[model samples]
Target: MMKMMRVAVFVFLFLGVAAGAARAGWDPKDDEKAQQAVDYIKKNAPALDRFFVHAYGFAVFPDIYKGGLFLLGGAHGQGYVYELNTLVGESTVTQVNVGPQLGGQSFSEIIFFKSKADLDNFKKGNFELTAQATAILIKSGMATNTDYSNGVAVFALPKAGLMADLTVGGQKFSYRSR
Candidate 1:
């Protein structure tokens, strides 16, 4: 059936993109990449400094690859999770969406947990970000007074590429002990 074929092709393309991203410079142990991400965020979103210093925990995904074609799209990235300034674990993110969309992009994302309970829930290996979850785009002079909706605040910085997508998607995160 045409529907089955379309689904098959979508899966193939999604997996290819995910595999390519995994093979790219996405190593969880890349300290330099992690540091660069941190520095970029601090410099561009100074207001987040307060959040960074005060957050019970946070996760930073240095580089995420996203791509889409027609009605299918996905993204993947690896990152480090920290608690009280100490490395706590490694995390991976995967997102899938369906809608009218096309193109590809790369970006960095950070999520801050406002409380110990929130961080604990995220570290439980079943954390997910629904379509309702929103991420602020990092820009110069951006205000940091953003409240933690649902105990979490997210920020994203575009790195490279371009994408035009209007889709419904959510991100799922899996964590592992460091």
Candidate 2:
């Protein structure tokens, strides 16, 4: 009985510590940052305004930090999800790639769902961007020729740093309702 009690206590403490560590990386002002990111996209890539208007929903990540060394690289970011412009939840994205790559960078990203079913799939936790998925880098006149490849259109604006990579990876997302 004592051994079982000790093991249970250890598991509880470990889970608590893990949760705290996860929350530690989040900023109280990230909501504000997400808003800023939306505004930045509006200003920098006015052509994307159409997606904002027509998308069934979207996820905005204010800043994604990414790095690569030799054959392995990964990226992570936290963001907010909106439905018809209404804030509904929070989301996180993590990506891993393997290729001959080097360098690092930070950027803001937004993914726009073309239909309710697409957004619903995202919320249901069944959405993933495969290695073939591509994001349109936001810039003046850049998005004018782009459209949703699948049901969602992804756009990214560089924030800082520089990375040159030829990698094949997938992005996995998790969502939590607010």
Using TM-score as the measure, the top candidate is 1
Which structure among the candidates has the greatest lDDT?
1
Each candidate: what lDDT? 0.81, 0.80
Q: What digit string (tens of lDDT, one per residue) describes model 1 on residues 1-178? A: 5796498476856685655453333346566666676787788678788889889999999888988878778888888888887776778888888787789999889999999899999999768887788578887787756878888999888889989998999898887765
Number of clashes recorded per candidate: 0, 0
Which ten-residue region of model 1 has the weakest summed lDDT? 18-27
- For model 2, the stretches where C-alpha displacement exceeds 4 angstroms are 1-31, 141-143
TM-score of each: 0.85, 0.82
After TM-score superposition, the amount by which residue 42's alpha carbon in candidate 2 deviates from its true location, in angstroms, is 0.9
True-structure lDDT of candidate 2: 0.80
lDDT by residue for model 2 over 49-134, one digit each (tens)?
88898899999988888877666677878789989998777888877776766898998889999988999999999988877786
